[model samples]
Target: MSLPVLTHCPYCSLQCGMTVAARAEDDGGGWEVEGANFPTNRGGLCEKGRSSAELLAHPDRLTTPLVRDSRREPFREATWDEALDRVATALRDTQQRYGADAAGLFGGGGMTNEKAYQAGKFVRVALRSASIDYNGRFCMSSAAAAATKAFGVDRGMPFPLADIARADTVLLVGSNPGDTMPPAMRWFAAGRERGATHLVVDPRYTASAAAADVHLQPVPGTDLALANGLLHLAIKHRLVDTAYVAERTTGWDAVRRAMRQYWPDRVERITGVPVRVMERAVRLLAESRATMILSGRGAEQHAHGSDTALAWINLALALGLPGRPYSGWATMTGQGNGQGGREHGQKADQLPGYRMLADPAARAHVAAVWGVDPDELPRPGVSAYEMLDRLGTDGGVRALMVMASNVVVSAPRADHVRERLGALDLLVVSDLFLSETAALADVVLPCTQWAEEEGTMTNVEGRVLRRRRAVEAPDGVRSDLDVLADLAGRLGRGQYFSADPQTVFDELRRASAGGKADYAGISWARIEAERGVFWPCPDEDHPGTPRMFRGAGEGAERSSTRGYFATPDGRARFHVVHHREPAETPDGEYPYRLTTGRSRAHYQSGTQTRRTKALLDAEPEPVVEIHPDLAARLGVADGADVLLRSRRGRARMRARLASTIRADTVFAPFHWAGEQTINALTNPALDPASRMPEFKVCAVDITAAPAGEDTTA
Candidate 1:
């Protein structure tokens, strides 16, 4: 029997390094999975990661292409040739009938970096679709927007993950590393031990809150108020770094004066955080030796996400956190390669080389690369939510091709999104299973699962790694890139296409030109030679970058420091927002505020984890987490079957009483679909500025279990 090979865990952004010690397959094949820490994950995998083998080897994984003849018709198994011809024919027909803008393509961040890179190119060159966005839009768009506005370039962190350990203080707002990336918790833990204060700001009390010296439980959607409160304290206490403000930034006076309009007591009236707690948080942050203000989906998932992030940056600048040792904006991205995916120009408003579509220079560079007339490239399209709203409307956005996403579960105001998607004349899905979105597609093309393919992926903190193949793919399953290439060939765009993933990857790298996102220094060959290197490695002589900018190595300069803050008014805008209820506040009908998030045992939406027997056994059905007080009021005991009803929809599940959730709110993991899926009851109202749906907060009503229903005593 051949020995098992070591590898990394596939679930979550931490990308916890692991060794999948290979053993000879009983079926006479070689495959393996075990844990080996690869620096990022520190040699650990969550429950979902350990059971990934089940998901990879699941018997039901799609192995063949299936295409539907007409609307409402069942998909019939078809040969690969037939599938490609149909796709090509559709593309041509749609372009001829409605122009390029009529059709749209949405990319996925979960795909390997190579697949994601190629998919962006294929969409523009082969299909000529101007309306395209990625699932990453829903996760980190706010932070990305803020970073680009501040740095003139977008980077996840100016420093690296390991740098957090040296920080004297860590200010985390709307981020929970303990549950999502447990290993990342080491940074906070190390900071706490070094006499550093840990301040947690969230509406919900999380594991992160438990460890923090102070937990500022502001009301939901009040991050701006909380942030402004901090800036107010900093200025009031003379903690404002005048040197940093004068030399490194602009627009301070307007923001400072505006902040003066709202003090802690006034801000406390709007945000739920007490005035004293807000002051303490501000004092703790300002007094620390080195402080880092970290951000994540919590702050970014709102409509005002960009403003919220900018507010954080403003506070950082006012307090001199920017460009310091371990002080600056640290956004914890949720998806693997979410940062990389955006860098590759899959965004509707962007082009290759991290250039905006609207920029003449950026447009020309990309146009030159693709060998197309600038006019032939359509103007930028709307955001993902707007795309859904415009689905099947006057602009001819009637056809949608979803690659590696389950929009039905992920999109907000899911019912409206479903209606919008239903308007599509053609809905094509390329994925591993008959996903919830796949169920809506006219064509469901089976694609390769993670372990069945070889590619590269970039994690949350900007570390690039290789996705090594461990097993043979099931019967007819193919990689998403291969599917795209095949369709491109049939569509007469074969000149730019190739089946070898390495070739596709090379083209993607060439598109980057080795500058901002230089992968020119990275290659499959280099990865095989060494373990794997961080990107922006520009040349062959250069070794891969492990951590983000503190310079690379000897003679490398520290990521240029000047204490530049990333806010428009130079000062962090303290949104003195009043206490407004949630998007769908619990009315007379629904009494509980429904908060959704990940569970310790499963990944998002359960699309991958539900297939694992061990994972399923660990936590089978969906369960609602309610505070003990709320549970007592409702006469619902732990494990009691309960129904959850919201203004939009309803779901039923077992109730698990706990003190973790606030009394007014209940928690649900958004992994399940059908009856227990949290999306069924989630409100899809988006943040006005960020266009992010209110996945974090949706009010609902809960009820006791009907008699005879299973309620484990």
Candidate 2:
């Protein structure tokens, strides 16, 4: 019998380590997943991870390339050469006729570091297009902006996931680890065993909130006010770490003055949370020896997400939580490789190494490695939503190439994005299945799945890991790296692209050297020997950094006071932020607030999870979650069909009478397509700083659907 292959889960940022092994022929001839001892999960995995092996040989797995001359025509099976040639011809024709920026590239946060890096290079060096972005713009961009503004550098969790167990108090802002990263809940349990205070702030009483020592149920989009109110109480009760603030941070005085207007009573009026609850939260944070605060997509997927995240960071800074052994502020990255995907480029404004594309030094360094002149690289492009919103318009992208992401069911304003896609001159998609977006593509390329590819992915802690291939891909399928290399050769940029994972990663390390998210010291051999290595490791002799922002003499990356932070002066900056209502709020016409999120049974867009029989059985379809009081008021019964309408569009879903949700708000899971897509009713208002769409809050009204109305449309 062959030994089991070691790898990480393909869903979520936790990336739990697991092993896949083939069963004996006498038994069922299938593969099974078993949890492995890893730092993040500690030999534990969720239902998704356990059933992930089903995707390896699913019946719907794409095995051949598909192409069609027009959207109205049916897809025809084609050879790799024909498909690549067709895609290249469309990209070339679009660029030649409409200009370089007319051909755009859209990527995903779930892609491996090598794939993400190559995509960034392909768009710049091959297509020479200034229109490229990824779905991560909708996920972690807000937390990234906030962290960069506060700490000068952004890693999902600057310390590590295991640090949660060491903290004496944990405050979670809109983070639901119980339903999301179920394995990580062990740390919360461990902390509780030691008398740690667990506090949660959310609009819904989620699984994580239910287990918390205190749950602050605030109104939707009032996170900024809730954070500021906690700070107000901290200052009023003399809980501020004055000495630490004076020594390690700047701009606190301005922030302190800004909090004068955020008194407990005023915050209660805005957030619907009581003043006593706010005071208790502040006291718990102050009294604990070590405190940690973490935010999630619920907190970062709003129009004011950046400031809301910054306000939480300000509270942590005021309490002197960062840089401590077991205390700090961090964001829970959602996608499988969200941390590394953005770090190694494939983002709108960033080059490899987390360097801004507009930075001349970065451009020169990357250009030299890529064998191109700095001038050949295109300028920074528009963001994800803007790129989608401008498709086929004048001065906008005429052709788009998508990789790893299913944007049709996931993007904000689902109906509008679908329309823009339909208007494109050419649409190309590379995925393992015909996702909602792929169905509209002019060419659909079958790509290798996780178990059939070998690459690297960075986890939530910024540690880089190896994903080893366990099984052979179908005869007709190819790895994404191979596809990129072939496509680049067809585009006359053959010398710059490599199909080998190691080669691509080596180039990435060189391009990322001397930059913020440095990987110069990390090697594949080292990763195997050490399980995984953290980033900012500058040289072979340097130990990879797991914790950052220490004082002088700690390490090279963690240098003296003058270099404590990544900013110009090395001091952490405090953002003086104020609360603002969401871009769209409930009113007389639309009297209920709408929020969307993931269901534990499925991942993003339901691309893979929905295809798995076990998971599909767990959650058969999308449903609208409403409080019992709200359902009663609307004369809706449990399991009743309801239609929700927003300014953008409408969706029909089943009503779930859940008391865990607020009476004034309704929730929906955005993991379906067609009429059940919750994003169809979502607002696309972008955050000024992060450009994040207001997916967490919008105004909507719901009514019972007419009898026998087709909700599946």
Q: By TM-score, how accurate is candidate 1?
A: 0.91
> How big is the positional error of residue 616 in model 2, measured in Å on the Cα after superposition?
1.3
CA lDDT, every model vs. true structure: 0.73, 0.91
Candidate 2 C-alpha error for residue 446, in Å: 0.4
How far off is model 1, as Cα RMSD? 3.7
Task: List the lowest-lDDT window of 10 residues for candidate 1.
Answer: 558-567
Candidate 2 achieves a global lDDT of 0.91
Residue-pair clashes per candidate: 20, 0
lDDT (tens digit, per residue) of candidate 1 on 349-419: 77765766787776666667667776666667777777877888888576788887788877766666777
TM-score of 2: 0.99
